[model samples]
Target: MSKAKKVIFVIVEGPTDEDALSSVLKQIFSSAEVHFHVIHGDITTEDAITANNAKSYVAKRIAAEMKKYAYKESDILQIVHLIDTDGAFIPDNLVKTRTEKGIQYFEDHIETGEVKYIQERNQKKSSVVASLCSTGKMKSSIPYSIYYFSRNMEHVLHNVATELTDDQKVELADAFADRYEENPMDFVAFIESEEVAVPGGYTQTWTFIREGTNSLNRHSNLRILFEQENLKSTD
Candidate 1:
């Protein structure tokens, strides 16, 4: 008899994130089942204003999807939320600096020491993570994990792009076209390397991705879920 495939649900902001994560997770888990659900498209602007709104939005959507599939919470092995920081800061928060490139924003947490650039227009008074954590709804949801991009997905890609030369850029572009088919492991290694300079928080974004799997264990929320579900790489 064959073992059952564990179901993992991922909720993201947009299609790009869905695509990117689908590719990455395909490389990470060989036998488990993974699904991506996008929320921003179906949600109203008013429903997305605060962290509670975002959580409610995601919760409703998750419930609907679950019903559509006739699957209960027990059927899912894990639920992951991925969102962008978007440069939202508290009032009178002056822990940022302006440079020729852009505005560098820093987190108040001394241990994190994260810094990332936020374009003036992209900066806001509230962030997605802040809102989600505000009501403690998402955090309290068991078997759930949350990950964030510093500014946005493009910003994360920019960090990787800046580290490569023209030739390397071309090679990377080609690799992406094929979804890094030739050497996905090397691509993963390059992104997680300390040599890659991801400003605005050192390796904050990379650390989020590399958690668990023995590379970096800074935040192991996702890692713990993977282990609990017994997800493993075919390679």
Candidate 2:
């Protein structure tokens, strides 16, 4: 008998995030099933949903999708959420709580002199899972992980090519999609190479793609989420 396929669900803020992540994750989870569902909004808004309510919004959506597909909770090995950190302020209460809990959250000072908040991986995972299962409307317990781009999707692509115009960045993303479709592993290898680089003095988004000894190492939220999920699958 064929082995059962493990399903992993990703909830992204918009098409760009979905597209970029789908390309990378397809390679990362080659043996398993990965699904990307767009929330049709930025971190702040998608119809009536806001960043503060994203957890609830995603949980309801997950429940609905599960019902539609008749998938039990066990069928879903994990649920990952990707959102841009632009203008999405971390609640003070949350910050205080996490700090008190001794979570290792950090503040990244960007070139624009703005501070970007990164929530600890453990905190984000536990909080998201709690929010999802807390509804009590879903049938099974599903693990959850949340990640955020430093500023926005466009910013990340721009980091890959600081000299590129907005139009050029879009083209680059499309090229990445094409390359990914043709050979996912090769695409990952390309990302892992030094060919991808963020502009000096900017938040190092490329560090998520490539492991290096830079000060920004392991700072990529998506990288953390993906690595955690990968580890879980192995266990």
Candidate 3:
């Protein structure tokens, strides 16, 4: 029998995230096993996570995934992490206050009753995210990279409505997967379209998001994934 295909683990926060891109990723990385591992919540914003321990935390998560899947380190190809920006990198002044408790994310500002809460979350989340971004490989020597969809994954995946129920999120993801299931490569084209694509190489693109309110707008640096796979996205 042929050797088992190496695993390409795509880490995400929840099922909707996995549902949205798992099919297309499997298609795109046909030579490998494309696995979507949902961690159930944003680890970046967790109370214990900080820049100091973020990598070790993620490394443990990856180890756990390997155990759960029965995959050896030798059986791993790479790790690709997909995260929502959630306006985490925006400056303090851009976060506007609100009467109601709901959080409303706009193109250039966020409206929320918990300004201090968001600010604290941002301080914690951004540092952890930035810590992850600064590294090219995990301590285990596995090739790793993180990509982002600003505001949230749903926003970049063609669903424009600001608020969605979990059921609605799943529906959108399934629909998106089906829309490109026949020609999953087309997903690259959609994400790389003029309006959604963040223009730059890997590091430069990350730099771009940290500037001004770009992180709150609808944008993504996922085109870099296609580029890594030697697939050119339309300019």
Which numbered prediction scores highest in TM-score against the true structure?
A: 3
Clashes of each: 5, 0, 0
Q: What's the lDDT for all of these models?
A: 0.47, 0.50, 0.85
Error of 3 at 172 (Å): 0.4
For each candidate in turn, the TM-score is 0.56, 0.56, 0.94
For residues 1-235, what per-residue lDDT tens digits would candidate 1 score against the true structure?
Answer: 2226656778877665565557666556646567788765423123335544666666777889877776666566667776554333322333344334433333331111223322222233244344454442332343655654544444454444122344564454444636654455654554554543232342353343332221111121222323333344421
Best by lDDT: 3
The digit string of per-residue lDDT tens for model 2 on 1-235 reads 2227767788877666666667667667866678787777643443454435656666778888877766677777777766554322333223332223223333332122111233333234334333432343333467776555444555544354133455665676676677577576664454444433333221244323222222222223443443353544632
* Tens-digit lDDT track of model 3 for 149-223: 987999888757387889989899999889987798688898888878999898898998888988898889998
Deviating ranges (above 4 Å) for candidate 1: 1-3, 41-49, 52-54, 90-128, 131-142, 160-182, 195-235
Question: By lDDT, is 1 or 3 better?
Answer: 3
lDDT of 2 at 206: 30
**Residues forming the 10-long window of minimal summed lDDT in candidate 3:** 226-235
> Which lDDT value does model 1 have at 14?
68
